[model samples]
Target: MEERQKIKVGISIGDLNGIGCEVVLKTFEDSRMLDFCTPIIFASNKTISYQKSELGLEINYNGIQEASKALEGKINVVNVWREIPAINFGEATKEGGDYAIKSLKAAVTALKNGEVDVLVTAPINKNNIQAEDFKFPGHTDYLAQELEGESLMFMVTDELKVGLLTDHIAVKDVAQAITPELIKSKVATIEKSLKIDFGISKPKIALLGINPHSGDNGIIGQEDDAILKPVIKEISESGTLVYGPYSADSFFGSDGFKKFDAILAAYHDQGLIPFKTLSFGKGVNYTAGLNKVRTSPDHGTAYEIAGKGKADHSSFKEAVFTAIEIFRNREEFTELTANPLKKSRLKREFR
Candidate 1:
């Protein structure tokens, strides 16, 4: 049999105190992961060892300094930190937060240098990580600055994909951020992401309104009519399939969302509330429009249920599967785009 193609995937261990380690370890217990890609975990040897001992998992850990040292049947651990404090499950400490950031930075560096095909991050604590040096809201903003690309946070499930225009901002401040340029830029990023990362030829996007009943035609608010409508119109004219400023409240009820491949919300909660409501445990949070592919489980650190082997690895498992699929699709897209004959054959097969 032909050797299975190997794609290098970098993983950043999120808060050591949380279920990040538990889920990550549990997810990799399956040997089948080697069939898709080589997983490179950016974390300390001690941290992983502690988790393995605590969880009573028999997973093998291979310490390596470089990506090329990865071997099949062993989980490669790139020791980014030398000494990590003893972890207290369900507790968030500054040390754990700093360690999480360190892991993330190492993985990102590997990604930018072409050492990895994709990046799958574990969850980190937003509040615990807040400090003088770590000022960014979350991974989205931090990755955006590092990659110098406009990033969009999109939650993915088998049934729906939802993108947020403004994330981690206060609800009161959402209106101020809803300029036409911002909407246009975010939508364009989402469109490009769908086409390039997801291999969608023609993406259908649904845009959600800022107010109830789509601003009730200017009675509730004029931001939809003034900002969103013009932006959507301009994008549509540019040959991108986009519609809406659909009422946020009614969009989920009407099967109106099913018509489009993805939905763009005006702000954070507008998109996430319904998305999390429907896809809390099973959804995967994907950071789109980045130079490298990054995905995480949709749920948070879940400190309340950190240890005890009760954490579900389904989302993390889905995240790994999603990363591999995206990586393969991107490779296929790149190859086909370079060869017209292959592209034509693919189109014919789909048709």
Candidate 2:
């Protein structure tokens, strides 16, 4: 395999009171991770030092004032703020939330400015992170607004990928939101992401029904039969093939999800509940269809395990690696698609 350029990974430290810092530090403690990318952590050195002492860790890292000064083969900590805020483990406080936002905003700004190749964020307390400047449901919505593009909350792993049609909305409103236009738009974004980000040439997508048993052929509910099924048929005939309004209940139970490249669910709990159950420790939440690449762990802050030295870093580690791979895949796909003659010539030469 050809050696690729080292990508800069901008990381955000989530709630100080939770296990964000623990997982970030633990994920990069092995030192071998620096070979693939230069990690620039978006938090103050004082905060990292405090967390390191509390967690009894002795990891090597470098502190820098800017992302541009980050060194290769080093864990660079970009000091977002000089003063360290008060730490309260296993609790949510206004101070911790404020600090978390500062780190997040700084990293996002760097990402937008092209200072970093990808962003890997730790978990944040959604309730406490809410404020005047940040009024969105979560990172996916917030980043979508910031980047001025739609983002699909794609849950990814080695086995299967699941995306939500209606995210962070009430169950009753979910049915109304599943219009034919919305389904087509979301499916298009998912298909593009599957090709560019996952390197799938022709992706197969399956949509789960909004109602129980896919509305039992419109006997249980009319939305599935009226809105979803028709949209799937129209999209399939248009060149990009897609399947389903499959019963969400039996799809995963019978391993039907494995047949498709990606699965699109009607609502949040409908998709995430099953995804988490299957790929909890290894799944990555990829914000697809954006100009920038961002990934987060499948789990939350885990406030109960904060500062206990027991937080697992598997998902966080996977998030970083997934971001790197997606960035590379996007570059590769763009290069191939930029010129048709070159692709044809290369294929003919190989043959």
Each candidate's TM vs. the true structure? Answer: 0.94, 0.95
Model 1: worst 10 consecutive residues (lDDT sum): 342-351
TM-score of candidate 2 to 2 decimals: 0.95
* Whole-structure CA lDDT of model 2: 0.90
lDDT by residue for model 1 over 145-258, one digit each (tens)? Answer: 888577899999868999999999999999899898898888899998888777779999999999888888899988889888998999899999999979888898877888
In candidate 2, the residue pairs with backbone N, CA or C atoms under 3 Å apart (3 or more residues apart, or in different chains) clash, namely none
lDDT of 2 by residue, 116-209 (tens): 9999999988889889998877888889987856789999997989999989888989988888988999999999999888878899999999
Most TM-score-accurate candidate? 2
Alpha-carbon local distance difference test for all models: 0.85, 0.90
User: Residue 156 deviation, candidate 1, in Å?
Assistant: 1.2
